[model samples]
Target: MRRRDFLATCTAAAGAAALAVVRAGQCAQGATSEVAKYAAWRRFADTPFGRVAYVEQGTGPAALFLHGFPLNGFHWRGSLERLAPHRRCIAPDFMGLGYTEVPDQQDLSPQAQADMLVALLDRLQVSSVDLVANDSGGTIAQLFVARHPARVRTMLLTNCDVHENCPPPQMRNSINAAKAGTYDQKMQRHLDDPVYARSEKGIFGSAYMTPANVADAAIEYYFNPLVASPRRKAQLNRYLAELESNPLLAIEPALRRLKTPTRMLWGTADPLFPITWANWLDQALPGSRGVRRVEGGKLFWPEELPEVVADEARALWRV
Candidate 1:
């Protein structure tokens, strides 16, 4: 079948199946259960990028979840649990973050991250997916759709890098720190003091809606591996430096022409990626269903608001 026809057919089938899907709240409680199983559930795929680390759940048609910067697949634990009944959910740690082991010379650019996704999906035998992404992962998702449109059945994007605003002005200092090789040191500080890590001055405070509610264990799981070794720290720095360039500019035309069904669920409180970019996306994509505002939500809200993610994914996928 033609790709467009396939997508249309899939949408219809998904809608029919969605009626039997469980309520988001009922499954949301299981999100924490997955957290404990994360280490034991973790699996690795030997891709050209490296031994890529990923976690999966559920069955049937695949749904791929791409997480934000410094976070791994664990970011999607809630969504995975909530949506597992409807789709095979897979979430992988990016090359420079989480538990993914990359070679010293691997490219960490946005384009390279997109290329890695292609390789990782191929290795998993998943030809296409319902693409769900947040933060930096949203940038890579745009690149993925532009470069491989046929591989995406639909998309659900949260606050993240958009065209021309790839490295948002607010992140200038963070990028500068990465260039100065102090980025890892800053992360070390957060790791050393979990109390401060969730403080208004720390990452969770700046990115999440409820900073103090963030657990210490989650903080360790997210930052520990990124600073585990000298090579890992250097890799993390390389990943941040790469965001300085704008890969989305060259792909704006492609995005404008894309037909993959997409929904932009943006966090209004996110200073890094404001709601304006979501408006830009609504105009850019032909298949856009329009933007949904997440009032008072921030960059990392997807982690804290999985039920919201699950609801939007089901809506976008017609399932």
Candidate 2:
């Protein structure tokens, strides 16, 4: 049997005994060549977390993709586009935020995000998989391995918190943001505040700043999600709650000890996660490389420059 089929068959059997019936089916589904070959809405049952939304495609060893704050699996479409041909790629929106909803879901903490990742992987019937995480996805990736070291094979960390010794630009903004009361209010202040006024423009510009490419779609696509619900203002408030944990300060010590093979991918022009941490991590984390400095992009490089992101990530993973 093919490696994906052989492993998936074993994983499905394990999942059947470990996960609920629905989830086992999804794992079976994940291993299903006909089903996973196309873009389809997928659901898993009995993950440690509640029900979830997932998209899967291709075949072979799994490559699980995770997104950053305020964005869902949609953020991974571009990256998946390139990878689906050779690898089985799965991307899911974080719980309570995306197409998946857990109204009573409390504790939107980083640890919870990590826990959910483990459950999701188990339900999908993937024993071990590489990860592609961006921003907070990067943050959650560490917690995932820290919590379930056995599940993560290797990681491609892009502009994320890999080094506790260094602080990225967004971490500073997140701290400044918490004081603004509501999540929306803080980011609003971030956008409106004079300190970031020019930077905010860059944030949008980085989305589509190539020569002769004047596109506003990048900015619109990102901002439209916030306005998704007028009442979502309450939903927006939850992200700021992360402040109570001081996740960055808390996780910094652990980053230095990560045993996973990691690739620090950064956008050279990223205002949020400046390229400085690349060097800091290189000096601190053994075997880590400051590969391609992402050229001309924003915090949302996955969408804006998936080819660049994938090309470098592919090189890093040697996929």
Candidate 1 displacement at residue 247 in angstroms: 0.4
Report lDDT (Cα) of residue 108, candidate 2: 62
Runs with alpha carbons beyond 4 Å of true place in candidate 2 = 1-48, 162-232, 251-254
Clashing pairs in 1: none
- Per-residue lDDT tens digits for candidate 2, residues 142-193, read 6776666667777787776544523344455654554454556533443344
**Candidate 2 TM-score, true structure as reference:** 0.70
For residue 307, what is the lDDT in candidate 1?
98
Per-model lDDT: 0.90, 0.63
Which 10-residue window of candidate 1 scores lowest in summed lDDT?
23-32
- TM-score on alpha carbons, each prediction: 0.89, 0.70
Candidate 1 stretches greater than 4 Å from native: 1-34
User: What does candidate 1's lDDT look like per residue over 64-172, in tens digits?
Assistant: 9999887899999889999999999999999999999999989999899999999999999999999999999999999999999999999999999999899899889
